[model samples]
Target chain A: MGKLSKKEIERVASLARIKLDEEEKEKMASELGAVLDYIDKLKEVNTDGVEPIAHITGMENILRKDEPMKKPLEGQAADAAKLVKMAPDSKDNFVKVKAVFGE
Target chain B: MIKDNILIEGEKCTAASKILENYIAPYDATVISNLKQAGAVFLGKTNLDEFAMGATGENSAFGPALNPHDHTRAAGGSSSGSAAAVAADLAVYALGSDTGGSIRAPSAWCGVVGLKPTYGLVSRHGLIAMASSLDQIGPITKTVEDAAIVLNTIAGYDPMDSTSHNGELPDYTANLNKPVKGLKIAVPKEFFSKGLDGQVNNLTQAAIAKLESLGAHIDQVSLPMINFAIATYYIIVSSEVSANLARYDGIRYGRSANKAKSLLDAYLETRAEGLGAEVKRRIMLGTYALSAGYYDAYYLKAQKVRALIKRDFENIFEKYDVIVGPTMPYAAPKLGELGDSLSAYLADIYTAPVNLAGLPAISVPCGQVEVDGSKLPVGFQIIGKHFDEARILQVAHNFEKSRQ
Candidate 1:
């Protein structure tokens, strides 16, 4: 658990596909390091033979009907469309984007 | 009567009047029907962290919910408006979704009561999803008893929500008057460490002392991994958030791109434009964590860490009836003054582990912290074993009663 380096932050940003400015990368490095440093304190605890409990209630293998159920009407679709239509770049019932795979 | 008329008209204005003006309850969240039938007045949908992505209400597209206590300070969020409404007396209680301290953090900051029930206790059927496994719908109110009342109404099985529990419903309000004599309460040594604000720590200690006077046994317990809860929580939650939010592809629900040159363009453009910066950051982080080469390094390892965190709680609960801590590391920071998104994320450091461990936790206003003659409330967090909210409330209720 060493500190997060500039390269790692850039790698994370690349994987996540968000272009980060230099300042953001620097801030993230420091902030993430502090967080990891804090989390490292967990190593002090002895958790030998303790069964790791993902869910507290001890529930397992929740079974449901395999049959496809009727899709309920989601009232949000029309509203969301209206919202999208209001965006500055929307055109032809679709959202326009910057050119991909350059000309 | 005028207020009642306003509420009735508001309900009629939309199919579900739970959300404030901007948000349409795109789906029939169970809270809608419950609130309508309970005669709970609808006062428009309240603002929240977009898709509940934040701990402070500042993340909402609608606008940051101003803290009623101190307008300049933040109203702790994801459930920001809910807590604000309760504190301002705008609504008796507002429905809030808590994945990791969305409800509790704001409640603590806003001087209200917020409860995150045992993971499966409430149905999340219509509530917007943010990390399915960790999300639980809870109540934010001015009093512990009011929270219990709301919980009683909302807690039950829902076939529509796959993760809902089939367990028998417990009458949460019925235990409000239960005695707290000899109840074992553990105050984790790590919770009171150096970084915690002295004033907030003092207020929390006072609350614990009051509980002790009510015959509850107080002991200092150690939860060393409690510190890692936030980091492990962020990796797992953001990973799930990225996956869950993938459905909003301009085809189904939520804002979608209007004219897509291609299907892929529609997805990227729609998401890029529609989602706020924080949402984008989380999705990207989650996508990266779950990516092919990094999945084992980040997501899988985080899950293992999550297991270790849960084991810590289980071990503590074995000896103590409940664990207590300050809900937030500090009193609500001033609005526009919390500094960065990362700081806001750490605000949940005190609350996220409960979500990761799938336990029940509550935030009750124990006392107020005053800065420069302005006062904001500090909350005492009471966490209990799975499905053990009854005892948690009993202890919290005793503390509340003693304070009065």
Candidate 2:
């Protein structure tokens, strides 16, 4: 739980695609550090050979058939029309997207 | 108003109905079929934090769900609308997803009963995943009994969700009146620290005292990792969310940017616009945490810490039958007063650790805190060991009945 460096914070922000101001970066660094420092306290516990319990109910390897099925809207113009009708904001037979690549 | 009509009919129950119009259940969601046969009408879809990435209802693309209890305050989310629907009597009960308190936090704020059953007790098939390892669907209802009944219907092994368990299904509602005469309850000391509102603190203490009078043993315990629960939760949840939400590319069911000549541009623009700010923040945080260089430093480390947090509860449960605490540090904050996204994220502090541990925790209205003569409901959370939902319900039902 080392202190989060400025470069690390910037990198994280870049991955998140958020443009953080200096104040925000500093604040996040400090807040994230405090959080990490607190979590670091777990090192004290001895988890020797403790089989990590990912799912609790004790079920494992639930298998299902791997058959490729047609989409619900497949070959049903009515379903496609219904989808278009229900879309909150759609245009030109497609859902719209914001400009990200230098529109 | 539109949501109210839909809930009243008990037909067409499906997630994202308003956006999708039809009751098309997601890949493994069983709630659709279960709700239909139970005579519960599905209202046209209510909005959620896209991919269930938010803790405040404000992250929905459709609109923020107003708290039925205090319209001015936020309804806790990603199960925001579900809680709101129940709070407003829009539905007798509504299903909600809990990955780190989405259901319980909002349930607490909205003054309704929210139950996040033992992880895997409920199926996660139809849920749009935020963090795959941590998500579970449970009921938001007006009464503890309603929650139990809903859990009875939905809690079982589902072949669709690999995470679903095949454990014995107990009749949670049948034991509502069972005497909690000797239940040992632990009250975590870390939960009652500063940042808790005075009124909420007093009300919670009173609730504990009342429970004590009801033949339950209330003891003070320390969950060492409890203070770090939020940070660890965010790191792990965001990382999973980053991966889970990557599937919503424009090529699939969700909206895609058409004008973009290239696939990369399409994905970037579509996600940026479709997702709300909080969703974006989590996705970014997740991506950062899971990235190559930071994986060990952040994501893996969080998992290790998560194990410790789980151990804390496991150790405590060895001595106590159930654990109780204030569901939120304070009652629902004013809707816009959270001011920034970080503040809103912190609202989940009280509820997230239970999710990290994958335990069953329920929020029941314990008392009311009056702010400016407006009575805002406060909740008390009763958490049980993994797969101990029946006992958890018994404890909560006993508390609710005794208070009545």
Candidate 3:
């Protein structure tokens, strides 16, 4: 495993969308480096011709047929309103967010 | 019955993180719905490690859940509160999500019965996502019989969860009194290595000896690939966590940042302020593994090695009915005694392999080990083939009955 530099940590943090301070960055550089170094042991195993398993259960293509609306999906309008109301900013039953097109 | 905060719907599902501390669940988790249908009463939600990331309960944003045996020691975690509550007699039983020992470790540390069902046997719908592939919800209870009963109610398929198993399930509580006579049990040599505490090793070996005297055939087996289980588990778990947690981008319902200049800033700042340290660390590590240029080395390699670990168990199960061992390396440690996170991850060696293979395993109280003058509980783990909850539960049940 390569040394996890501060800049690399920052880059990963950016991809993850979690900001880290300089001190946290330094700590993660070492901590994540150690973890990645440990994970590097997988290289010892010969996985030649072995297919990687994404799901353990053999079930595949579990297709559910499109059925008619089952009693309007059970939730009352009050529940819908309450769920929509949970957002920090909302109006007219829609969650409000900053405009995608920046000014 | 108590439920871990990770299960969603009526109450707040904080998952022991500040980001969703006040987030109300919009729907009942499939397991919760199953329990309710069986007339199980809710005793309330319990604390856990943030996002079910840590092995010890210390990583909770609220605070670590204390061990029922010793107040200063940590209850084993991620499902810490549930195990502690059951051990402390605060609830009859509780539900906990296990994605690499979240249920078993805490149950072991707190001296309660915790069963991590085969993946997809219990639906993950409405449960907060930690690792999509390895996660399963199971019961934490005071007795193996109670764990069996709870499993009977909650084990089944759900249309809502595509990964849900549609296979038939046996009555988990039906064979509680079944004798272990003629049952073949394998004790993996790797689980009793030098890393195991001396007292814990003695107690676990004694427990196996007792089972042997009860007419069960016991033999030492080798699972050489077990050495790499923790490394593979962390890589896969972190990679999945980074993807699953991307849903909490401040737009939907979680904590939002104040006065964000742009959507990107809103996401970065909200997570910065809301997520706990361990959660962020996992996300960073996960993102790095799944990032450009490193995917093959970390995520993909881990998955292939995971196949080997799973194969080890499959080979053993071809002959043995179940594999038994100590659930943890040692008893619960003092609140902050786990030291660095790396050491904690390494301690999960025994339990991680079960998750990687998506097998059913239960941790039943074996006895206690004298640690620092305190008699802390040890867990005897019984692992079975995929979807063989009944066999493991029956073996555990007979063991529990024999103790009386």
Candidate 4:
């Protein structure tokens, strides 16, 4: 059975880019560990010859014809505007964000 | 009626997540577009588990959707509101997304009919991405015929969703009159194993017997790999979730954190405040699994096991027309009954396997069980091979008609 230590939880939390408080980290350490422990049973299955598949649908390389755009948004300014307006901080057409690096 | 809530222009498609709270969709999802062309009236969006992550509706950022049958019981979820609405006659039918039994579980718990179409059978272009490969938009309705009608409207290929199947779709309701007489049905012994409540088991077995009386041939089969379904389903779902949810970085759309000094801080703080505990847990688990050193051991191994699980279904379907079992191992649990995340994941055992195999399955109300003075609904699940929805729907419709 695999157990996630608090440190490992913190590390994974960082990778996920979600801030977790001390209490949450502690809870996740045990809860997630229990789940992983259950999942660890998969190691027992002999999957030597099985090929991993991404999706069950056997379709491959589904390419569509590059047709001229019908432009559903052609005369719909409200729709295009609504798309940008969803952003918390949006200007004319672009969304504003904090500086990536401190000066 | 579209559970495929993507960019429904000028409408809020939150997936019940606070992160996407107040985020209005910018364009119509393909399903919604199809429904509109069919002259379907849009009732309204139903509530769900936040980001469609939890099995119980308790994970909804707003509040858990109560089972219409019992106010204290949970409407099985992430499509919690969809099922509850139809169950209560609040809506004629509603659309719901299912990754691992989101639609069926809730429908079963709420005592309604729910259907999860074959993967790529419906367009995913406008639906919010959960576990992209597993996430499917489906219908929760009052009857099997309604499910078929909604499916007829919403299914078919769209150039927008590359994975969408390009084929001539059948009018699902056309086969409603087909009799189940002589239809071969496989009942996997694993579905009746430990963890299934005794009453639920009895009800399901009786439902199977009823089908047999209708002339369906039933056989007991073993699917040894069934044990690995939940683990494999969670691993694949989480990995895909980690990748899909990464798009919500605050700057693009959705709720953003204020007073962040750097972009990194903005990303972390926004998600921490916006996402719920279960969603965060899945993201972290997925991130850990997909992380460099653990990738081969966890993600790749689960995928291989997934292939085996799929093989199990293929082998069974070779001999049977559809597989029948209880949609849920038990009747609806009271709200907050499932305290831990792992327990909730385990409850998905029977439902998850169908998703892993990209098969079509439906949850039809079989009967009711007495629980704590309440008559809780039991669901009988019928799973069919890939693109074999008509066969299953035929069986379900006949079963439902016979009960009526």
Top DockQ hit: 4
TM-score, each model? 0.83, 0.82, 0.97, 0.96
Off by over 4 Å in 1: A1-56, A67-103, B1-23
Q: What does chain B score (TM) in every candidate?
A: 0.93, 0.93, 0.98, 0.98
Q: What is the TM-score of chain A alone in each candidate?
A: 0.63, 0.63, 0.81, 0.81
* Candidate number with the higher lDDT (3 or 4): 4
B364 Cα displacement, candidate 4 (Å): 0.5
Root-mean-square deviation of every model: 5.5, 5.4, 1.7, 1.9
**Candidate number with the higher TM-score (1 or 3):** 3
Higher-DockQ candidate among 2 and 3? 3
Error of 4 at B238 (Å): 0.8
CA shift of A36, model 4, Å: 1.0
Off by over 4 Å in 2: A1-53, A56-103, B1-28
Number of the predicted model whose TM-score against the real structure is largest: 3
- lDDT, residue A71, model 2: 60
**What is the TM-score of candidate 3?**
0.97
State the C-alpha lDDT per candidate. 0.73, 0.73, 0.88, 0.88
Cα deviation of B5, candidate 1, in Å: 25
TM-score of chain B of 3: 0.98
Docking class of 4: medium
The fraction of reference interface contacts (C-alpha pairs within 8 A across chains A and B) present in each candidate is 0.16, 0.16, 0.71, 0.85
- Report how far off residue B226 is in candidate 1 (Å): 0.8
